[model samples]
Target: MTTESDVAYAHQPGGLLKGKVAVITGVGAAGTIGAVTAAIFVQEGARVLAADISGAQKETALSLGPAAAPFQVDITREEDVEAMFAHAVETFGRVDILVNVAGNPGGRRGPEVTVEEFESLTSVHLLGTLLTNKHAVRVMAPAGGGAIVNFSSAASFNIDERISMAYSAAKSGVNSLTKSVAVLHGAQGIRANAVAPGFTLSKKNHRVPPEAMKELGGKAALGRPGQPEEQAHVAAFLTSDRASFVTGVVVPVDGGWSARLA
Candidate 1:
């Protein structure tokens, strides 16, 4: 469970995520938020299982060392979610953290939106969140405790001209789901929180032109796009001991964009 590298990145000599076991979905190629977060977790003494629907998962896992494992799981499927949690328990003995990052852009226009568009986004963002937390809590409650961090989007709170209607609604639902889990499960020693990220560039969603990107960054008080590591740090903190009393909170890792609008 422990590895040589996991000891190095701790905030303290024995850092926050030490001895923890985390399963992060949507870990893609290097330079991604999920990839950076997984490395940070392992470096801080957590055994990490990085799951992605992509075939690149094996390559991503190999670089993180023996303490890190990768599983190809489709968050849209209940069986895949079940198998993912099972794989974590099988590999590391138990699950300490569950981070839900598997989401898609519901790209249809509002007038053209189909039931499928709504369902696709809901399946990944809403149902996926429910399935992962359900199985994770099942194990965590009996075993004493655990933490979960689900990804919501700042678009849910702030109207984005770029993202579609379904994407916004789906993320808004995730925010609601986060609170429900936390409210229902807190006494059982299960803590659930959410991270609402601003427009951070990803391989798939970085479609904005350079001029627009600059304009968007300037809209934030920080006047810049958020780095993936910035969000990773927040994710790491929410799952850490320092956040022991934190649950049902949706922390915006938005570079103050939400407040800028205010």
Candidate 2:
């Protein structure tokens, strides 16, 4: 079995985000996408506040070195969300980027889904995105500009037996929310975009059998599952000045999984 320590982050830093400050949510586990993104952000010359509901966030942030700090936050709560940004400002002095990568997997199908399940999914994915963006804009708007990257999923556009209906609907809502933020905040130099990842081998999927992983990954045009770092690289770029002209669009980091017709 592959272990979290076995994962390698080989990307060389080029100072893409030099001197910038970022607030990244969902950074709890060591090898998860959120943690990897936090590492990459620090590697690219940005100070990061790694926020998550889990207490493990403290250690995860420490592992990234001095450029990173940890903040415990429940995105579903408005008070926690507000405190999160305030903490970021106090730690890093300013916020230039906000990446919402925190989410829960949906296993229930349409018929199997309950009202509670639906609300739970929407609360975390949709409502959480709204709260983060709202507070992020509050800080970014006055700072003259900032970048926001919200996580969406391939399930938002493609039907998969493994994905729940509520998850798809919530992700769809995230896309619309992303666009709305871009339209309303673009004038203020605040750029909002979404990344729709497909079949990524995050920490939660490490337990999946190799055969099963191959079968699922083979469905994608790349014939392989994506790594958290692959997704992180794109996120880093989107938040950097390199993507100054990019905004209001959902980029699929799915290795062509969403592009396949069959």
Please report the candidate that would top lDDT against the real structure. Answer: 2
lDDT of 2 at 108: 86
lDDT of 1 by residue, 81-161 (tens): 889989999999999999887777767666788888888888888898888889888878888778899989888886776
- RMSD of each candidate? 4.0, 7.1
Indicate the TM-score of model 1.
0.91
Lowest summed-lDDT stretch of 10 residues in model 1? 1-10
Worst 10 residues of 2 by lDDT: 1-10
Candidate 1 ranges beyond 4 A from true positions: 1-14, 205-207
Question: Which sections of candidate 2 miss by over 4 Å?
Answer: 1-13
Q: Could you give candidate 2's per-residue lDDT for residues 1-262 as a string of tens digits?
A: 1123212221334788888899999998888899999999999899999999988789999898899999999999999999999999999899999999999888789799999999999999999999999999999898888999999998888788778999999999999999999999998989999999999999988888988898888877888999999999999988877777789999999989899885
Residue 207 in candidate 1, Cα distance off native in Å: 5.2
